[model samples]
Target: MSIPHGAASAAARPDRVDPAVRRIGATLVVGALGVVFDTTVVSVALDDLAKAFDAPLATVQWVSTGYLLAVFVTIPLAVWAQARFGGRRLWIAALGGFLLGSVLSALAWNATSLIVFRVVQGLAGGIMMPLMATLLMQAARGSHPGRVMAIITVPTALGPILGPVLGGLVLHLADWRWMFFVNIPFCVVGGWLALRNLPDDRPEPGGPRGRLDVVGLLLLCPGVAALVYGLSRVEGGAGTTGAAVLVPLLGGLALVGGFTARSLTRPGGALIDLRLFRHRAVASSAALLFLGGIALYGPMMLLPLYFQQVRGEDALGAGLALIPQGVGALLARALAGRYMDRVGPRRVAVTAFALVAVATVPFAFVTAGTGGAVLMAALFVRGIALGAAMIAPMGAAYVGLRHQEIPDAGVITRVAQQIGGSVGIALLAVVLQHAAAGAHGPSALAGAFDRAFWWSAVLTALAVPLCLLLPGRPEPPPPARTTRTGEAVDPRRPTV
Candidate 1:
């Protein structure tokens, strides 16, 4: 259900992060960093994998593709897994799976083995990311969303900034295996924290477990994975019309359509409750995030390629140049969260999306000789818009949700953003391919990127109007307890 604007007056939502929030937030962030870094960090090592395995580029690409499919396919299982084993247990187990996969991947002797191991990593990672958000939000209990989100977003903001740099450095220094090796410390520490800090809430003291939603899983899992697989194929010379693209793309759609129909029939029992979308916040936020995935991911691809191809910078140089954007993203969180609580996500999302579109205009006008300082400043501003833009909708999605509802919300939003990302990358790849068809110079490549940036700006612009549909001000926190005699009573509940 949509949380009415009046539910949380200006007086209700706190602007500051609480001390308890800080403790859990820190722990969750630490555990989540491994997944974030591992995902982005591996992108820069694809070429190394191909060479090391003496395999075709397409074959080596599965190191990433297989992981992606596995992530999507396994994501649907998260709701069921969390409910069956409890969040704490599921989190620890997933982290353990990821850690084991990382170790096995680092030890693999062949590309096929590495690809198989990556699937394990993806399955674990897909669950962890959504579960991380769900656990943290439930802990927050609808207070200080801005502050809570700021801490949660650190990994995301840091990933783009550090992942490529870290990946490049690893390839230059040690070897590709270290990419997987680096995840060890994070997993070990995260697991330790889970064991120590997280509350254990086993279902009914190990009585009969929740019935598995077998039909929903069968429909939703492959359905989403198929869609992403289709998009991945769309980027190559095959194009959207080719059999390679159309078969899975259309087939995935049919399956998903069927899943939606099936979910409608299952109510609370569906793996992901489709009824949740009836709330304006969830549905609208999902839409904006869908577009956001395109705007953000599409431009992310263009930015690095732009610097390297147009400016003739090395990978390290491009990473360094993009540092300003990362800084902006990190800096925006504190302010964005505060304002989101104060003015509400609707207003903040509108302004932020517009700002993103405006900031992108400069990149859309780039030239071969464009000054680095000028472009850097624009990127910094764009990052600021992006940081706020991402947080507002994310916080809004959970505004009126009951505790149990958060798991489904998490899965829905993750799937939306993930599929949106795949769509963005595929579309931009096609556009870039066409624009560079006859181009032969740095100037020509710059033009191709300019066109792509325009597409990104248009995407952000498109999301602006939809901000109106986000949840209003977070419902004011519940008032303090009172006794029959009007004496104050503690509302404090047992730590869960």
Candidate 2:
């Protein structure tokens, strides 16, 4: 049995990534950092914002809640917007909107105003997140997906690491308003680079621009927002059966179910083509991403709280303690990207998920007196596995997708991960609360976190087998040919 030429070449040199792809990824990351960073940074500032406005914490919580709801509302619109407008135009427009929102938020006079302004930021950010991946993957033309995804995910990786630390620093030295003001540099630089680097891809004049499915939009936007809102309410210590949680959750599920039915019946004209679920890569990746979200975000809530409530660290100290996990995630990126491309997503995803579960086990046994070095070591390993776990599925979702299909896939995957995160946080929050009910000492609190961490570990482990459903080792690339000037050109590369 002879090895295929493409396979041999791929084996020989798996790290070949295009310079243009790198440029595009760099440009997108600059803008995306603001969105990702803002979400995490603001998370730490909600308390401060409440104090600044002399408002009740519940009222001020809307500043973050409103932003999240707005994001859900606009997420489904990205595919249509990018189709109606070019990617370049949409990128700049969204950046401009975020910049405006940031400015307004910084100047907000009250909680209500800040909430409204954050909604503006969310609307713009919702578009950029999916568009960033769609643009990069389309540019890569199905080649080097893992590497491209690594570049695409730079902001996500950095957000967890830097957002809180930056937030803590800002609050220590400045006012809460500076949190929004800090977004100015990212927006300005991102907008400028986007103009220069991104290709103008507006739909051709008189081309068949599909009509926006207003019905589908109406069903999905509010459905997703309601779902997220309900879950967030749960995170705020409300029970699942509470009116605030159940009303929105059931309503959201009903609306989303309606959208799903409508989309399945009218795939061609729907806001998001539900038919993409037919693809094995898309379907499996979506399922795994849901689990990955729980594994990632559920513990995220517990880690900081464990540090604060059980270990007696302040906000800044808690944030600083998480630095090791971030460092591990960073270190895993390059290696994970390379191997995901070379060996494929399935093996990597399974191995990574298993490792994540294993790493999480130490936390399940956490005690008030657990050594800091030991816990940090566990977090570092968990971070590495989590990073690879995310990169694998994200890159896999795009496998075998066409240029036009990329945006829809992007939207589906993003929504899945996000909703999954909401679910994770809510469920974990409930668990922690129930386990710690009436607890007074740090020792008792540590035991409650242990139970919650156990749930996180079990949830993560469930995905290990599901990862087998992901696409196996990538097929060999098509052969490269030399141009007239002897420049090697990949025949598979997209000219668009």
Candidate 3:
């Protein structure tokens, strides 16, 4: 990440995101929209799906849980798969898999079939999530982490806000199948763009292709799935001591522990390379991402439920109520990226996270009679803070890494955030379940939501100090190298 002192500062290009970066960023975001929105959209339809399939609520929930477990199983394979097949090829392939799965899921005849197809989609999605970040970050090459991340995070910020709305509409009008149908355009357009735009960074002729880390994959993949399964049980409204919670949680922990030890014992380049944590920025970012996941996603569960159950809004109405938060996040990217480049992630993240804490307080004090306008205003501000909070730590993770190291960093950060979100949602679910148990009114439900918001605010506050560990400033670009000819040589690889 070293740069020549005389090179132009990154601030010079603050408003001028690289054209290639824009192209790559747009393509990745388009494809990821399906995955991101699919997650949130399908969530609103769980009850519909249960009734449609004539299944128990618990049985139908597996559609989401199975997909999540499938995702965890495939994430550890991204680094090896990309190195062997090249990022462009893998991107299109994964997108195609997701497309196929989407179509199959739409045609599913039963809950069991739907669950299986969703798992297929999840396997493809798991690869896409981490690979998307790796390809973009590696292409940007640490030159403009702030702007790069701002572009990378559009899907994340939008997914929570828009997914539910879209899902609500689908459930309201059409059947559950339309939820899967919506993804078709994003996948088709995304894959077509990748075929045209992405770089073909395959190994040089006769160059060695890396072997899969079979042992590491065996240990870590199942380990992640186990942990996710355990967490999903919590969302199923199981008590902390229930078998649903303990079996998977304990089993997942033991497997994860084994993976950690095995990853440590292996030399360099284990499946995920646990050694990345030794770097202060990388380690600290992972921790913050974990807590940040909880902060951003935990309340997502409570907010909609609160509106629907207490405020008497339908699913669509609840989704509409959350629009301000997404709008705020969408609006903050330019400023967040600019200030991050100017003042560093530490200052930006700490301020952004503090804003998250402040915004969350309004919810903690909500009453059955709270004004809708007041709550919406608070949500808008919360979205703005969350958007900035997410991007700052994300960009900081890659601040000092070499282009080759981006994939591993991508996997680490992606896993941390995913697991953290699961834990956050699960914790809040447990609290809400216990708080509302035997209660039977809007006021009682509002009380449960208030407690959950308090926990979310506390979790966010916990992440503020960790922001101090992020890298101070974006480093200058590496000194350019030229060929024997007078013309500047091509960069090692083109980004988009």
**RMSD after CA superposition, every candidate:** 4.1, 4.2, 3.3
In lDDT terms, which candidate is top? 2
Candidate 3 lDDT over 1-496, as tens digits, reads 2121222322345346667667888999999999989877888898999999999989989898888898889888899999888888899999999999999999999999999999999999999998998888776656668888999899988998889999988888998899999999999999999877777777666877788888788878888898888888888877778998889888888888888998878887678888878888899899989998999888999999999999999999999999999999999998898888878899999999999999999999988999999999999999999999999989888876767778999999999999999999999998888888887889888888888889889988999888888888655554555556643322433433
Provide the clashing-pair count of each candidate structure: 3, 0, 0
| Per-model CA lDDT versus the true structure | 0.82, 0.88, 0.86
Runs in model 2 deviating more than 4 A are 1-15, 480-496
How well does candidate 3 score on lDDT at residue 158? 90
Tens-place lDDT digits, model 2, residues 1-496: 1111242243235468766667778999999999998888888888888888999999999988899899899999999999888788999999999999999999999999999999999999999999999988876768888888889878877686678888888888898889889999999999999887777777778777878999999999999999999999999978889999999999999999999999999838789998999999999999999998898888888898899999999888888888888888888888899999999999999999999999999998988999999999998998899889889999999888876789999999999998998899999999999999998899999999999999999999999889999999998877677668865555665444
Q: Which ranges in model 3 have alpha carbons more than 4 Å from their true place?
A: 1-15, 489-496
What is candidate 1's local distance difference test score?
A: 0.82
Which 10-residue window of candidate 3 scores lowest in summed lDDT? 1-10
Error of 1 at 204 (Å): 2.7
In model 1, what is the error at residue 190, expressed in angstroms? Answer: 1.2
lDDT of 3 at 25: 88
Candidate 2 local distance difference test against the native: 0.88
